[model samples]
Target: MQVKKADGSDYEPNTISAFQRSIQRYLEEKSNLSILKDKEFDSSRTAIAAKRKSLVQSGKGNKPHATKFLTYEDEEALFSSGQFRDHNPEVLQRTLWWYMSLHIGFHARDERHKLC
Candidate 1:
């Protein structure tokens, strides 16, 4: 599968690993920024803590679970009816945005704890 970066760059190889590395780098930068901005430290730390608690409560933090993917039949139906592409575009977009946001947030929290 091909992965597209936010900057419109395309990368081939292991997309999961690439995304992980990108999140790591982002977290590192965020951590450095947090360290320099002592005034915002508490707020940032609290936000991270809340997210950590949420993930734990949801049974998704550091636990092995089945990764959900769109099935071939689902994809075919979506493409054929154009439901996901048109009628529910907002839902699809929002879902993707949330997924990326949560992934990045959790990854950043992990990196912050590691650094600490």
Candidate 2:
């Protein structure tokens, strides 16, 4: 199963793996067949595995990016800017966000609906 991008280019190995898993899940749900284990799909399974390995070797797999976090100086700057104060509603909300991010693991990427 050769999955391609919108531009007709090849998908990354990780993306291909995800697509394979999704197809495997659909097959299991509708036909009670396991593509990962069934003998009928041995060639297909090997092809996907070999393709993924080749893509990974060519650096088309997942890569880690540098993580960003508030430094001590950044925290000091925020405190000096008076944004952490609870007197004003806007500042209070920001303060609450900062505190929740630090204490309750509420990062910027967290869905807002999860807070409710």
Candidate 3:
């Protein structure tokens, strides 16, 4: 089995063997082969998840669970406040289109698709 880095990078095969050896040595010393059979793996998975969640919340993770929804009036006030009032029509239209896409859940990755 492969072990992931704390930052969630992929494991090299050599690193996996080293990790397995360390865990095996520790378990042998503890007389806890049962961890290999079950509980510790589950615990480790939970720990990884918790760490990832913490990183995401702390803004150290690049992925975006970072934004919250805006209230309707707040959103309206923001877009209607004349920020783009002097911009060309095409620019305002594109900006509004992007705002609508994001509001409807088209995120960073999804914005690349043809708007069909």
lDDT of each: 0.53, 0.80, 0.60
Query: What is the per-residue lDDT of model 1 for residues 1-116, given as tens digits with 9 covering 90 to 100?
Result: 23356887533323444454566578787765432235755664455455546545655444344345667896577657654444576856745654555466545457645533
Instruction: List clashing residue pairs in candidate 2.
Output: none
Flag clash pairs in model 3: none
The alpha-carbon deviation from the true structure for residue 50 of candidate 3, after best TM-score superposition, in angstroms, is 7.7
Cα lDDT of model 2 by residue, 6-36, tens digit? 8987778878778779999999889989888
Q: 2 or 3: which has the higher TM-score?
A: 2
TM-scores vs. true structure, each candidate: 0.26, 0.63, 0.33
TM-score, prediction 1: 0.26
Residue range 1-116, candidate 3, lDDT tens digits = 23467997754434444565688789888875744456757776465556555555655545345667768886667569754343778657767775677767675665556553
Candidate order, TM-score descending: 2, 3, 1
lDDT of 3 at 82: 57
- How much does each candidate deviate from the true structure in C-alpha RMSD? 18.3, 3.9, 10.7
